[model samples]
Target: MTKPVIVVPKGMEFIRDEIGYAPAVLANGTLYIAGQIGRDDSRQLVTDKEAQFVQVFENMKRVLAKAGGDFDNLVEMTSYHTDMRDLPLFMQVRDRYMKGVLVAWTAIGAAQLCGAPGYFLEVKAVARID
Candidate 1:
């Protein structure tokens, strides 16, 4: 018997000082992406809730693309938000990015995040690939 191999894509960062995990991985046509906060490519946190939400979705899309996936392939999206009141803001930004592409969504409230000024959110997504 042979072990099934997992083909994790490249360009995902390995930040040992941070959470000590790769940003994303691909195995058996499924891509598991790490939680993406409201940050840009440089990893700088986006402060504004509305802007940060958009940035977070954009970051997720980029990682999915690197894994040979897209928004249409996304099956689940999990959001952890520091402020429960920001749910509307999150949706407002999500609507702009989703463009009618529906997927399973779960939103949870948390006390705080890993970033300063309490970065609003961290998103984890599971996407299917061709």
Candidate 2:
């Protein structure tokens, strides 16, 4: 069996070294992306919920791109939100990026995340490339 390849998109140095986790790992035609939050290049959390939601998707897209896949390749996703009340907004942002891509998803409410302060949501995804 081939070894898993850790995918580290450009400009994700902190996530690779400081955070000690690969943004995604590719193996056996599948890519597993880690939970992505709304932090910008500087690693500062965005304050707006809508912005955060968009950033999460954008971050996932970056990982997918690094793995030679796209949104259409995504098969499943799981999201953790600090507030379930933001579901409608989350869905709206999701649709903006997902468009015609069909993916199974699950969302759960959580009291907090690893980095709380301004962070509200985290999204993890799985993609099949073959």
Candidate 3:
């Protein structure tokens, strides 16, 4: 067994220092990314639904980049939504980033999520760097 490399992007010290979890972990050429919420770099949760969705993906992208991967390297994704009805808009924003790159994705409806009340979406993912 080998120790996993913790992936923490620049200026994201809070992921380990405050939040007490690795943003992502790299082991055996695979990156396991934790749930990404709508918080901006300053940690303020985005209120607008559409913008929040985009922010979540941007957060995920940052983690992936820190792990030396990208959306195209994604192998699986699981998204939790507080309001399932927002699926249409969410997919629109997701597709803009996905850009035809397909992965095993599961969309789940969560009652509530994150530290803030308005953080409606959380996306967790796995990607292969090899």
Candidate 4:
């Protein structure tokens, strides 16, 4: 008899609790990662534009690493910003982390985010694993 099992890794406290979602699910040889915000390891939001952008990617990286994925494995990204004026700095920081892989990306602007003042950026990513 063959029974399918659901596998969720550890160190994903946010997904299991705060976020109430799985970080990644491996099925049929693919890993689907959920959207990630600019919150740090402590789940505290980084409000500054540049700071938030960096934290956004860092947060994503931590989750991805937990799921055995990495930036090179990423195929797509979606970014949300409270202000479009910060686009340049966002791009600058994004490129630094991306290493010029030029993966698919979508950047959008919003009036606000669910946190303290000055939370200018939010990012989510999708990565593939064989």
Choose the strongest candidate by lDDT: 3
- The residue pairs in collision within model 4 are none
Which lDDT values do the candidates have, in the order given? 0.76, 0.91, 0.92, 0.70
- Give lDDT for model 3: 0.92
Against the hidden reference, what TM-scores do the models get? 0.83, 0.96, 0.96, 0.79
The alpha-carbon RMSD values of the candidates against the true structure, listed in the order shown, are: 2.9, 1.0, 1.0, 3.2
TM-score of candidate 2 relative to the true fold: 0.96
Q: Write the per-residue lDDT of candidate 2 for residues 1-130, one digit (tens) a residue.
A: 7899999999897788997999999999999999999988787788999998999998999999988989999999999999999999999999998998888899999999874567889999999977
State the lDDT of candidate 4 residue by residue for 1-130, as single tens digits.
2332233445556566786667666555455666556766666776565787888777677666766777888887888878888889988998888886777889888887765566777777767765
lDDT of 4 at 103: 76
lDDT per residue (tens digit) for residues 45-120 in model 3: 8999999999999999999888888899998999999999999998999999899889999999989997458878
Off by over 4 Å in 2: none
- Comparing 3 and 4 by lDDT, which wins? 3
